[model samples]
Target chain A: MNPEKVNLEQKLSRFDEHWSPKVVGELNGQHVKLVKLLGEFVWHHHDEEDELFLVVGGRFRMEYRDREEWIEPGEFVVVPRGVEHRPVAEEEAHVMLFEPASTVNTGSAGGGMTVADLDRI
Target chain B: MNPEKVNLEQKLSRFDEHWSPKVVGELNGQHVKLVKLLGEFVWHHHDEEDELFLVVGGRFRMEYRDREEWIEPGEFVVVPRGVEHRPVAEEEAHVMLFEPASTVNTGSAGGGMTVADLDRI
Candidate 1:
């Protein structure tokens, strides 16, 4: 095992993609990913996996079917499995996600924005 | 679903006990815990669970038999299963943990510091 810790900021700095998530750390079959969000992401739902989003900087608005909740920096929200949701950000938002390693960025919704394979930073 | 975001700083402000992790969120059978650390914790290893420690504030030192790693704010470390490790902090450190819900703080080594049940904040 590598003795060095994974510096999240250093990892985040290497990528500039708006929706692409870069894997930084993993444990217990879960992956910790860093991503920057701008505009609205695809509305999707993971049938078997739940997702956790932590805002590191800026604000993120989680758009559910019924309502929308804004998450400020240092706040987090958990989207349960099978719950359709979308992340919308007016400005660039630095975020961290904790979810299963098998989770796809677009979930079951296959589209142009779907990222089947994610990059590791 | 609550549709409300969990403010990490707000939850952190509610607890002052070190080593005792309070559950702030849960998804996919995994719990997101917040804890404060000061001084050295027990040397133990999880048999089936891998622990993820993300330093939210201050510095945290992970002690292993081979080497020591210092995790700074916005950094994280993954301690794999069956690896003996301990956390040492000279000053107060705020940390977030992402792991399975069944993971015990003391791992398989039970003692006074073992928290069988965690409180939600």
Candidate 2:
């Protein structure tokens, strides 16, 4: 394959759907995605692998059953497996997520919000 | 553990060594690191895994057996397993790298330039 560079702004321009993730890069067997979120995400959890949420721009908040935390730009959070949580962004926020390639954003609770396939950005 | 954010500038301030990677985050069995480089790196390759190099600042270059590529800020490159390549930076450059936590900077050809341990940033 030809060498490619994934610039943040360039990737953001390809997708306009909020909360929908665009695959930016893949390392080993994991996928790195960029998403723009402006509302609340459903409460869900992964059963087998941990999820990383890195705030690239704006502010985001994630609430777990036991606690809630705010993530500012340049910050990140690791949501452990099976820990129920929801992500909320008051304003538009840009995020970078790292997870296993098999992971689904909404887990087994598939719905309209679930992104069908990862498109290379 | 307390919730924390990893701002790129904040992480870079914690270390000053060029080419020595500092662990900025960990997910599953992999490590995310930030490295600053100038000059040339010893030619090496990982036997079991691929390596990712994301340029965060300045210009960088890499030479593979078949071709050489120039990487500018906001760009990245992936070196497939067992591919011999050398990374060179004309001026000081900052980069983000992702690999399995067990990966050594110099792999088994350890000597000088090998970082002792990954310190949290």
lDDT, residue A52, model 2: 84
* Interface RMSD, in order shown: 1.4, 2.4
Task: Please give the range of 10 consecutive residues that has the lowest summed lDDT in model 1 chain A.
Answer: A1-10
Worst 10 residues of 2 chain B by lDDT: B1-10
Question: Of the candidates shown, which would achieve the greatest TM-score relative to the real structure?
Answer: 1
Candidate 2 on A28-77: residue-level lDDT in tens? Answer: 78888899989999888788877888776788888877788888875678
Taking the tens digit of each residue's C-alpha lDDT, what string does model 2 give over B22-92? 89888778788899988999887778777788776787888876788888865667776677777899999
TM-score of chain B of each: 0.97, 0.91
Best by lDDT: 1
Comparing to the true complex, what docking class would candidate 2 get?
medium
In order of appearance, the predictions have TM-scores of 0.96, 0.88
